[model samples]
Target: MIRVLLVDDQTLVRAGFRSILDGEADIQVVAEAANGADAVRLTRELRPDVVLMDIRMPEVDGLEATRQVCADPRLSGVKVVILTTFDLDDYVYGALRAGASGFLLKDTEPSEMINGVRVVARGDALLAPSVTRRLIADVVSRGRRPEPSPRLNVLTAREREIIAVVAEGLSNDEIAARLVLSPATVKTHVSRIMTKLDARDRAQLVVLSYESGVVTPGWLS
Candidate 1:
């Protein structure tokens, strides 16, 4: 089963998410936290497979909680999927950089939300399409120029191409189709890239791709 921890300051939002996730056969709402501090504590104690984290909260926010969770060597198996209103681009970007596996808009459809949980639980990152655009715009607007990692030179030409495509928010299957490679092959390449870059997950890979200049905001538009 995919165990999940719901972390939101709003009681009604937590209840609603519980109601949606409770109906899924493969998912279980293991616990709930009203703030980021509680969420981090429960995460270390319970070690749920996924954390549905709200970006804003009292005392500690989701972004900091996510950072703490990701940085904890003991909670390495835990994955955080940020929950926000989609307008919080800065928070979303910060969450991803803090090692969040992905994000979900608070208004996401029930089906999509469930699927997103499953995706991250299975070790895949899940950035929403709109979130990807917003991330790029936010990065560009901040004047944080892409500082291509020198380590990028370690990637093969093909791997560099794949990284660019990944930054475009394409799935492994979509990348396979575009590159005329098998899905298995694409997955293998992605794994290798992660290892070489020391990325925590595909979300980190996307961030690296942007900051490393493999993909640019203009290309995204």
Candidate 2:
């Protein structure tokens, strides 16, 4: 089962989300926090599989909460999915830099929201964060780049190509078509890439791509 922690300052919003998520057999609403501080507290206490973090909150905002939660070695395996209605560049970039596994619009359909939680919980990435891809490109282009890491050199040529495709926000089928390979083969390559890179999944792969300069931001296809 996917254990989830819901973090939203609005009570009604939290109730609504809880109602929807509680209906899913595979997902369990493990905890709820009214603000970022509470969220971080509950996260460390519960160590949920997925955290639905709002970008704005009292005391500590979701961005800082994500950073704190991610920095904790005990919660290293937990995934934080930034949940917000705004598509502002700041939120996108900030959430990612804070180590969010993915970002999703709260206005997204119920099906999509459920899927987003599931994907992040399973350590896969959401397909609709193209805005994040754009932000990553912009941020790196503006010179807020990270230092080099030799660990990035471990990716094979095929893994490097897959990472580039991921940075472009291409779906698996699209990547398969572009590379003249089958979707299953593309999935295998992606899996291997994640294993080799020590990435929890594609979301972390996206993070590593820009952070490690494996695929430059502006250079994404």
Report backbone clashes per prediction: 1, 0
Q: Top model by TM-score, which number?
A: 1
User: What residue runs in model 2 are displaced by over 4 Å at the alpha carbon?
Assistant: 127-129, 144-150, 171-177, 180-192, 218-221
User: What CA root-mean-square deviation does each model show from the true structure?
Assistant: 1.4, 2.9
What does the lDDT read for residue 116 in candidate 1?
Answer: 95
- Model 1 scores a TM of 0.95
TM-score of each: 0.95, 0.82
Across 21-47, the per-residue lDDT of candidate 2 in tens digits comes to 999999999999989999999999998
Clash pairs for candidate 1: 148-212
The weakest ten consecutive residues by lDDT in model 2 span: 127-136
